[model samples]
Target: MRQRPVNLMDNPHADRVKRVAQLAGRSAVRNRRQQFLAEGPQSATEAIRAHLGFLKLSEPAQQMWPVGETVAEVYYTQRLIISHPDLFALVQQLPAHVFVAETSDQVLQAMSDAVVHQGIVAVVNMPPHSLQPSPGAELVAGIVRVQDPGNVGTIIRVADASGADYALATAGTVDIYNPKAVRSTAGSLFHLPVYTRVELGTFVASFQGRIFAADGYGTRVLDQTDSGMLNGPTAWLFGNEGQGLNDDELRLADQRVAVPLYGLAESLNVATAATICLYSSAMAQRRQDPSTS
Candidate 1:
């Protein structure tokens, strides 16, 4: 059958589509080096329909956006509040966006990291954490000298799931909104607050809780601490993965603890150690909690 070649004009919106593509493709329209996109609902909808990958859906507002099958990830939450559950329900099923943000547009925009500020942003929720520990809140995590976004986000997730409270990242730690850190948190960034400080020594001094450092050759064993002083409100300190803790920082700790490693590996990753330390405290606290007991 000899038929006329179909014109893209037959699609009617072809020109508009081409313009949108041009806008999306241009570096200025997207973002340049060192600049990222903080998209709003308008941008999110556009991207969802456009099907761009690598967008890590964060918290709160991201949780509310509707996503298509082309989404890179969708991290949803039971904590999300919506007047239209059915509408959001559809967003939940999509595979693209990581449903993490709250319902506010302004917040979503603030958390957005891209240069364009897509109006809809990926915000990792840092739940309010108190210095004062609850009866059940026995475990604590602190970040010292680590400044990478990936490291911080990974540590935050490990700490939260391990049931740690009051994550204290020292003065040198990366800003939580560095995009890379927020993305690394997965959906766990929405779980707890990580405190940033201008001074490491003074910050730990102010912390009234028990302090322990995760060192390779420390005098104490992490596994044994569960039966010892770890049962109390404890803060587990993690040093930079490369340099470990400085001598001055080590002096600030009430105890220097080590994770028992039977394997040939030299030491555990700071994030992984943090998880172990936090969960150890959490398990002890859970066992001690009057209600749970």
Candidate 2:
């Protein structure tokens, strides 16, 4: 007996109605549907460029593409009805393999999470990242037990801005693929390399340079720390917001520095602290260089 192929083009309206009527959470999107949501034009662009294998594209994003040009294959929507033409035009020229959808709502609902879905979303083939340490890349940011996706994405953005080679996240950290995290980076997710692991202390010890840990309670202030101490390749370890650095992890630090709180606030958010620390280190490195100025 021969089985007939089901046409996606057939009964398009019914397919769309069903998808819009039923939607699931972001986490469930991966497990139940075997798909995860990557929102915003920029994130969608990065995921496409990375060749992470985006399964489909939403209707409203048919025209909007990234700025620069690259030849990469991706599944994209064909119907081009965009309110923002300029933005859409830029996205149109990218290296995309287009797929005309049966209906907009079906594609929209299939890719969206809890938050309002950006006009564009992609179902990407998620690659499992390795936790092993890298060679020759000395500058590192260790996020231990930071739970929020927004904070995690912000830190990754700061790390990329500071030219840090890669980020190492410990167990109990937020899911890096969370839509909120992906959005907060504003496309910095593509610029940085990230990894997750259970053992941070062992990884930090393996690196060659000064190990600095950021803590709110530390007596040594970030500004007051000897600038020369960060001269060599450095690894900066930042901890959780509410609990601060765990006792065993703190023991690995060669220098523990604190960001001073001038106002009534008890402590800075983990992401904010990461931005300051990474920039300060970058400044120190720049000052040491002759050609940068």
Candidate 3:
């Protein structure tokens, strides 16, 4: 038999409820606590699965704490309990260390950052700074000083979907854990290692691969660029939306590559450009070694 959810939390202003709500509105609270809010059913489901996966890891692996310490607490409305019974069932499978609770609609609204809370939210621990891309990573997507939270999250999603080994945000980039950003990821954040607050110079030095800068005024066109160059390990750098890559940032890349503009459209959105660049590399890499596909 499935265990019933805890009693409803009806007070929107309860101390505990307020603290969770603050995570969405305040960066200081999140940084100090090393936690962020995963709003909606999609994020909540992924967070729960990550926590459960953590429990199954070997003792030594668990010590590394990669994805296991992900979900800290989950709060859902009565409607969610009934509407997403499957999700609730997954929540029931969580061990005693995880907190699961039922909340009133008003309490859920107060706890959520989104206009539509989707009747669920999970408090997720930020992966430790020590967490990094796997040693043998073949393709990586990097964004430098990209201020839009939505773009950051979307790029992470694209990187995951395109089968890139990992994603990263340079120090000046927007917070990947921002509520809007987290919502935009659509749960891909849980699928891979996404390093944040990284330094571009250090990242470039650490990789033994070709680096391509996605620039509007580059000498090489993405579609026309040598396929052989992208067949090996590669890292892509996407710059800020408005200014693109600065002179210094562009100098770090082995090549500045531009996605060709077929029509009168001014330029592609950073996320859209990333989709093309990453997919191109993914396809080339898979062709080079079918086993990786």
Global lDDT of each candidate? 0.53, 0.62, 0.84
Candidate 1, position 124, lDDT: 19
Which lDDT tens digits does candidate 3 get at residues 66-124? 45477788888878768999888887887666678888888999999888679889998
* Candidate maximizing TM-score: 3
Instruction: State in Å the error of residue 74, model 3.
Output: 0.4
Q: Provide the clashing-pair count of each candidate structure.
A: 29, 4, 0
In order of appearance, the predictions have TM-scores of: 0.57, 0.75, 0.93
Candidate 3 lDDT trough over 10 residues, lowest sum = 55-64
Task: Indicate the TM-score of model 1.
Answer: 0.57
Candidate 3: give its CA RMSD in angstroms: 2.6
- What lDDT would candidate 1 get against the real structure? 0.53
- Clash pairs of candidate 2? 63-88, 64-88, 64-91, 65-91
Clashing pairs in 3: none
Worst 10 residues of 2 by lDDT: 57-66
Candidate 3, 270: how far from true, in Å? 0.4
What are the per-residue Cα lDDT tens digits for candidate 2 across 181-278? 77777776655556655477667757777788898888898878777866568888888878988888888998788998888998899889988888
lDDT of 1 by residue, 148-249 (tens): 677887887787677565466676665554555655665454345455553666656666678788887788887676555767777778898888888888
If candidate 2 were superposed on the true structure by all CA atoms, what would the RMSD be? 7.8
